[model samples]
Target: MKLGFIGTGKITAAVVQGLCTSGIDGLSIAVSPRNEATSSFLAQHFSNVRRMHSNQQVLDHADIVCIAVRPDQAAHVLSQLRFREDHIVVSFVSFLTCHELVRAVAPARQSCRAIPLPSVIHHTCPIPVFPAIGPVMDLFSTIGQPVTVDNETQLHALWTLTGLISPFYDLLGSLSDWTVSHGVRPDTASQFTADLFQSLAHAARQSDPIAFDALAHHAATPNGMNEQAAHEILASGAHQAYRQACDRLVQRFPILDE
Candidate 1:
């Protein structure tokens, strides 16, 4: 199958690298020339990839087209391209909705919203949120686990979760920096924090299904250091600040209706 990416940015490059390494047969990709460095890099590094002169060229050559532009640029960029009813258009732009895209590319057979992080490049599995489409489900299944959403609201919730990633990384970085200040080497502190978090995440995933609060309680004993620290942070408004940040995301990207 032929796949074309409309925007050759970081996320697009990651997806292209992931697909290239996946060794999926007969898969060829054409990316737009907007991000020349990344597009050229992919073309040079991947035998099956090519850098296209324009976004329209990508749509012209591929069976599956991924609209990888930012939400702000989506309307303007999509206004210039044309698509057929049979083409599959998967958009990674967060604020754009299926209905809006359908209107942008009238008569397209299938259109879905997908939110993929750079992790897809390592075949670590992308969290895909589709509005119940079989072809999209089949395509993303090859890269990672596919999640289907019943409505656009749920999809927006998924997007909100995506927004949390950067803040989460910042929190981790702050903790790692504190360790470095306490005398550990910078690299060692970051690595230790990452490894410890990875193990904790793995354990949480494998453990019996239970409320996260229960696990937190088990991990933090009564009047212990962990509990004391947790209480102090909560008292310092850290937890509330995180909640407010999430609320702000929801407000910024209001839920799209079905």
Candidate 2:
């Protein structure tokens, strides 16, 4: 497949990295000129990747065009490009509806919205949603697990879930900092927190039919250290604060109508 990326940002770089590392055959990537450093880096490290002179060149030369621009810049970028009827256009920009994509690339037949994280580079599980279209399903599945959604609302929900990752990381960082302040070495604190999460993730994956809440309850036994910490967090409303943050993200999702 001849693939082109319209905005060469972090996500685009991650996707290109994933594709290059996956050893998938017959793949050629052309990246936009917006992030010159990333585009040049990919071209230098990957044999099949090239840097296009302009975004239009990406649309003109590639069979599958990916729009990776920020939501605010999407309309302006689309307004300046052209696409053929048979071209497949996939967007990583959240909340832009398929209809909006169709209108952007006027004559395109296939349009899809996909969400991919940096984890995709390792072929680890990635949250991918395509409202419609089969090719995107097949393509992303090669890089990670892919889920198909039937409507735009579900796609928006998926996007909100993606937005949760950053704050989750911040929460972990706070926990790590707390440990460091308590005299744990900084490196040891960070490593311990990372390993703890890794172990928890692995446990969740391995424990079939075991409910997560049940696992947490078991870990937080009556009068135990875990239970005491949990109580303090709940009493301080930290959990509620996280929930409100998530709610705000849902409210701020960048729909095409905006």
Candidate 3:
């Protein structure tokens, strides 16, 4: 299979790295040269990876094309490229619905929208895709669990929750800084904070029919620290704030419109 990447940003870099390291033989990868450092690095490090001179060149060389351009640049950049009717286009552009992408890449009959987090490099994340396509889902499965959604609205909701990732890290950082303020070593504090969340997430993932409320009840003993903290956060409107933030983020996607 031949694959082409239009933007060599961090997500593209991570996906390329994962694909190269994945044990998928007889696969050729082509990357646009816009992000020279990343494109050059992937080309130099991977045997089957090639750095192409232009976006058009990348499209010309591959059977499947993955668009990873930023939202602002997606329309303008894609307008210049010519895609064949036989080529498959999988987009990672946030806020750009599949309808918009189809218009942008006309003649390309197969178009898919995918959301792949940075952890995809570790082959550990849920890759959500809209309007399920066999080849796109199969390709994403190599890097993460591919979840094919029936509608764009459901897919956009998953994409909206992804916006909370940064906030999650910031919350962890704040907890780590609290420990530091209480005299814990900086490195130790950071490591503990990260591991605490990682183990919690792992546990949640392993549980069958997992429920947030069930986990909360299991963790919070009577008058225990966990219960106290949960009460404090919830009573302080932190949980409500999180919901509001997610709702706002979802509004940015036009597909979610009523």
TM-score of 3: 0.96
lDDT of 2 by residue, 80-191 (tens): 9988998999999875777887799888888888898888877775656666567777778777888877667677767777777888798789999999999999999999
Candidates' RMSD to native: 1.6, 2.3, 1.4
CA lDDT, every prediction?
0.84, 0.85, 0.92
The Cα RMSD of model 3 versus the native structure comes to 1.4
Candidate 3 per-residue lDDT, tens place, 1-258, comes to 999999999999999988887788789999999799999999999989999999999999999999998999999999999999999999999989887889999999999999999998999889998878898888989989999787888888889899999999999999999999999999999999999999998999888888878998999999999999999999999999999999999989885543
Best by lDDT: 3
* Model 1, CA-based lDDT: 0.84
Task: Please give the lDDT score at residue 116 for candidate 2.
Answer: 87
- Candidate 1 is scored at a TM of 0.94
**lDDT for residue 106 in candidate 1, whole number 0-100:** 68
Candidate 1: list runs displaced more than 4 Å: none
TM-score of each: 0.94, 0.91, 0.96
Q: Model 2 clash pairs? A: none
| Runs off by more than 4 Å, candidate 2 | 254-258
Put down candidate 1 lDDT per residue, 96-129, tens digits, no spaces.
8778888997677888888878888877765666
